[model samples]
Target: MEEFVPSAAIAHFVMKVKDVESSYAFYQGLGLRGIDKFPEMAIIELRGGTHLLLAAKDDPMAGALHASRVGQRPDFISEKIDLMIAGHTRADLEKYRAELMANGYSPADIAEAPLYGHDYFSMLDPDGHGVSVYTSHCGDKPV
Candidate 1:
């Protein structure tokens, strides 16, 4: 059997948003830097390292750029894309978790997942991207 692996894996992700301005503004509030902006789309780069593309619904080429709307696509929003980021400690997880909640993003219960022995919290972005912060314990707890 032959298998192929991409050198860098995912290059970036493009998300279709109803309003680029609103989506750009939301990510900006989260400390992301806007790298590109057009009438139909806006690109925001996060501090931790990831690119976010906000594509306006009216964009003539929007359909070609995005997949089927998952969450609150055209109207209401839901968390469809679950993005997990790494945290080393509970404090690290709490820090981002609280910041997100205070900023209007509701974080689900912070709990330990037995499968991986990690503590995690989750939230959603403007376009319904599921973002999560987690601390992996690998079964060992802080003493």
Candidate 2:
């Protein structure tokens, strides 16, 4: 099979954000292409033209089952990470970590993942949604 940069298979996905401006800046820093920006919302385009819609939400996690407005805290069974970027190399992950650090963001150290035997790192956007960037273990395989 021919190896190609995969385009997003869907039209868009949304991240309820606390601040559009900051969220916009944050994703932009991570190399997602900027599309449109608004006071209440912003859109960042991924490699295949899929849009990551960043819309303002007073409490982005308010609707989360792990959290609640009026009830006992619940033990969450799911991860906070909503997006993953795959096509990076181990060295690319290191470079990205350094770049984020220099820009005043705290990103997790590159760690080895046994799943695909690749390295990855996680970071939080301004609104606190988790994003993971990792080396592609797909090699010549179509993913």
Candidate 3:
């Protein structure tokens, strides 16, 4: 069989949280474009126009789609990979980390991944979802 390829991209990432406003602010703080927000939901746009849908835990459609979902607990922190965003370079990661810190967010110090040799840092969002920002590393060599 011949190799198959498809041109597809992510359109939306749905997240349920107890406080839509808080989650919305977090994404906006990360420089993601926010397309207005209400008490129940928010639509934040990524660079590729991908929308990160932050829905209130009790949102009708969100509740219907999932049997159960939990919100963040102040005492617990999740270190799992919830989302990963790529910057143009390692310097971008450093600047972004500074911005996050200025905004009162304590992101971990940037470090290089030994396997990939790209810089990255992780922080918990308002909903306790782990988010990683990394320097972009695509393809095998220069284009």
Leading candidate by lDDT: 3
- Model 1 segments beyond 4 Å from truth? 1-6, 47-49, 63-79, 84-86, 114-117, 136-143
Order of quality (TM-score): 3, 2, 1
Model 1 lowest lDDT segment of ten: 134-143
Per-residue lDDT of model 2, residues 1-143, tens digit only = 56686664777666667788888888888878999987677899875567887767754433452233255334532224334455557776687679889988898888765346667878777666778776666566554
Better of 1 and 3 by lDDT: 3
Worst 10 residues of 2 by lDDT: 73-82
Clashing pairs in 1: 72-76, 72-77, 72-78
Q: 127 in model 3: Cα distance from truth in Å?
A: 1.7
> What residue runs in model 2 are displaced by over 4 Å at the alpha carbon?
1-8, 58-88, 138-143
lDDT of 1 by residue, 25-137 (tens): 87776546888888898988753456777877668877766554455355634434434434566677778777876887677878756226556766666667766656644
Per-candidate TM-score against the hidden true structure: 0.63, 0.69, 0.73
List ranges where model 3 is wrong by over 4 Å.
1-6, 64-86, 112-115, 138-143
Cα error, residue 113 of model 2, in Å, equals 3.7
Clash totals in order: 3, 0, 0
